[model samples]
Target: MGDDVDRIKSRLDVVDIVGDYVKLTRSGRNYKGLCPFHEEKTPSFYVSQERQSWHCFGCGKGGDIFSFVMEKEGLSFPEALSLLARRAGIEIESYRRSDGSGKKTLFDIMEEACSLFRTCMNGDQGSVPRGYLDRRMIPPQVRSSFELGWSPPSWSFMVQYIKKKGISLKDAERCGLVLRGNRGPYDRFRGRVIFPIRDITGRLVAFGGRIVDGDGAKYLNSPETEIYSKRRTLYLIDKAKGAIRNGGHSIIVEGYMDALRLHMEGYPQTVATLGTALTEDQATILKRLADEVFICYDADQAGQTAAIRGMYVLQQAGLSVKVVALPEGKDPDDLLRSDGGKARFNDCLKEALPLVEHHIKLLSPAIKDDRTRKSAIHDLLEGLSNIDVTDVSPYLPSLAALLGIRDFEVLDALERVRSKRRKTDRSFDTEEIPSSLPDEGQQSQEMPPLPEIALISLLWSECDLRRKCDTREVVELLSDPRLKLMASSIMMGESPSSLEKRWLEMGETFQLRVLARGGAYLDEFTQNSDWKWRHFCHLLYRQKGQMRYNELRVKMLKGEATTREIREMEDLRQKLVSQKGS
Candidate 1:
């Protein structure tokens, strides 16, 4: 496996691989491009040919080719390896166990099931599904491209077919293709038109089945399996990725057919959530592909409620979101099927409402009674407060008018909600603060001393200085636990670029910290002599020892320190005195 990975890496150049996703221009020794991982206008993302690595100074994301692909395509390490191996024309040795939990094998099973379903749809038994398609005016090309299929009504048919194909019954069950009964195994999907659910890389992972003739649920989807996670998977994302990127936006729909019809009707940048509500994971996937998202859900009350949840998810993911409310009693599929529906839908897209506005507009109908209206207005304002938008003040007048409330009342409500959130929301970044400091209500903790900050910043920016510095020692000198963990990772031989990427994954807070403060002291430390660096290190060690001594004294004063801790504090005090004398 290592040899295979090495072979794949040797065949695929980092610049070329990254260039496929981001346009790169030569900047001295490295290539530079706007980061695809974040919304940046300037080309702060650099590709270093010398190291075969890429890093974004603005967003702090940096990594080797595998990490890059994993972050860019949102795949696990194994998945990225498989994708790159396939791209480089290298085959990976099966990393699967004998019991068959390997994703690759599961993917193969799903693909085979899809093929069987398609064949069954095209066979003599496909008349009902084919007729339904025809009556819906679905073109042949759409059917072919989407690989739409049908499952026979008989439960034993798929079992026999799998047996004929020599597929494992256990594997079939793992893929949710069949269910084992007391008598025998039966097909999970029966008398239904099948739509295969694939990941963004076009790997078959699951299926969504719509009933053609049945008494059970009208639609059923494959249960969550090892290979398929509905929250992270969107229908047609594999086909819609390019169009989504090209259009700089994505159109989110409610149903598979709605997405398919929109794509056929000249809107290729559309996807569906497979009947699940929009999730943070799905929103994140879309945000990576596009900056804006327009939700075109059914215009009924249920759809409106769903649209609100979807909007909140997308907005919280930092993508600009809009809602396209279709005419009452219609969906994207219905609209596309009607005369001039395409033009009307296009107009609707143009007139899509900003998320907050749409939420208020949809909620206004519940204003029949004063108490109900006030409650709805309160919910609306609370939601608005949570949005990361900078200037909700501009929308307040409109919101006030919609709620039939005074402008001052709206402004006061916004202020109170925002203030409450600010007080209560302790973001992940807050965890990085020094443990010695009191929590939120106390005096603001000062930044770590300049010398300590300078030393860390220097280690991050200068390769030579970093190699000379004992990173484990540096980790001990830092007061912040997050910073200590970061330094310890470097000491463990992980590259600073890789750590930067990990910090980016931590969230926007760390990224901003790195951009604003982590690299700021680089010049000061880099230009200084080796002795000055050593002197700063001594100072850091002394300061940390004193801090430890003080903490132990506090514990002793509170009668919380053990006998061992008291002795350790005395030893630290002596060490600090000796160090001061030196």
Candidate 2:
């Protein structure tokens, strides 16, 4: 496995892989581009052809070719490896082996089941579903492209088929195509029109079955399995990602048919949420692909509520969100099927309201009524709290006007609500500590500091620094788990290339963060190892001092500070102050 990884690495240049996603230009010995992972205007993302790695300083994400593909394409390590291996023209036999866990086998089973379903749809057994599709005006080419299929109405149809094919019933069940019941294994999607669900990489993972004439629910999706997660999967994402990236936005609908209709109607940048509330994982996926999202769900109360909830989720993920308010009593599928519907739908897209304004428009009725005004304001405040204040500030006057309240009053109430939310998050009754501690600023606790990243990079790259520096205190000062592990490895004399290989196995986000944070300092450390070492040591000591100061402050707040501990706290505070001054 390692040999295959090394071969892939040796064959593929990180610059070429990343260049496909980001526009790069020469900057010194490296290439620089705007980060695709975040909203950055300045080019803070850099690629090192010499090192065969890339990192985004703005978003603090960096990694080699494998991690780059994994992060950019939203793929797992195995999937990314397979993708890059194919590109490198190297066949990995071990990757194809089904090690009894059936991870790869599950994908094969889904493909086989999809073939069976398509065969059934094209055969005489599919007459009913075919007629239904014909009535819905879904063209043959569209149906063929989406691989629309039918499951036979008999209970044992797929079970018998799987047995005849000599595929394990357990593996088919794992693919969510069969279920074990009182009468052994049976088909899970009998009498339904099958919509094969593929991941972003176009590999079939699950199915969405819509019933034409059945006693069961109108639509049934395959249950969550080892290979499929609905929260992380978006219908038509595999097809729409390119358009979304090209257009710099995505259009989200609620159902599979809606996405298909929109795609058929010349809007190829549309995807569906599989008729569920939008999830953070889905939002994050969209964030990676586009900067804006337009939600056009069904024009019903439930759909409206879902759009509003999804609006906040997308907004919190730092994507601009808009709501496409469809006409009442019509969904995208129904509306697009009508005469001149496409033109009207285009107009709706043109006039889509920003999420905040759309949210206010939705609450207009309650805002007008005396009975529900206060409750409506409270709900609006809650929604607004989920977004950044700058994004919501422009709408405050409109909101205040609707409530017959002054703008400052509205802002004051919002602040109070935000404060309450912060208090709830803390969930403790201690008094606030003074803000005289080390200025960590707005950095998240999960993000490794630049000094820690630099120190680790130095230790990994400079053998003399690794041999001379006292790494125990630096390792103890490190907070990020991956950084601490790498630092420990370097202290024990791990080679730079060996560490880079090990680093590739870590999570994409951690790799990006560490690499982006520390990659810039490699030259500086290499040039003046003695000066850089001392600088990083001081930063580590200051970090340690801040951590200790915070711990003592917490103890003091709880009235449990001992005399020696209090003295130590005072000493650490002075030391941190002196260090900051210096």
Root-mean-square deviation of candidate 1? 14.5
Each candidate structure's TM-score, on Cα atoms with residue i matched to residue i, is 0.65, 0.67
Q: What overall lDDT goes with each candidate model?
A: 0.77, 0.80
Model 2 clash number: 2
Which parts of model 2 have CA positions greater than 4 angstroms off?
A: 1-95, 427-582
**Which portions of model 1 show Cα errors greater than 4 Å?**
1-101, 404-408, 411-582
Q: Write the residue-wise lDDT of candidate 2 on 1-582 in tens digits.
A: 899999999998887677656656677688887788987544678899999998876678998999888787666788678778766778886354435454766776787899999999999888899899999999889989999999988899999999999899988888888999987888899899999988775667889999888599999999999989999899998788778877889999888899999999999999998766788988877886778999898788655854676679889998999889888999999999999999999999999999999888888898789898888778888888888655765676798888788765675577678778888888685556765644434333345666877777667667887778676776787876668777777788767677667667763345545665566645534458778878887888777778888688668655699989978976775676567668
| Best candidate according to lDDT | 2
Tell me the number of clashing residue pairs for each predicted model: 0, 2
lDDT of 1 by residue, 1-582 (tens): 788888987897887677656766676678877788987544568899889999987678999999998898666777778777766768686444456556667877787788888998889999999999998888778788899999989888889988998888998898999999999899999999999988775678889999987698989999999989999899999888778877889999889889889988899999999777889989877876778999888889866864576578789888888888788999999998999999999899999998877877777776546768777766677778767423354466677777677754664566577666666776542423476956643322224455665566666656777677776667778876655655666567678677777767875354335434545434333346465567777888778777888688667655799999988976785686567557
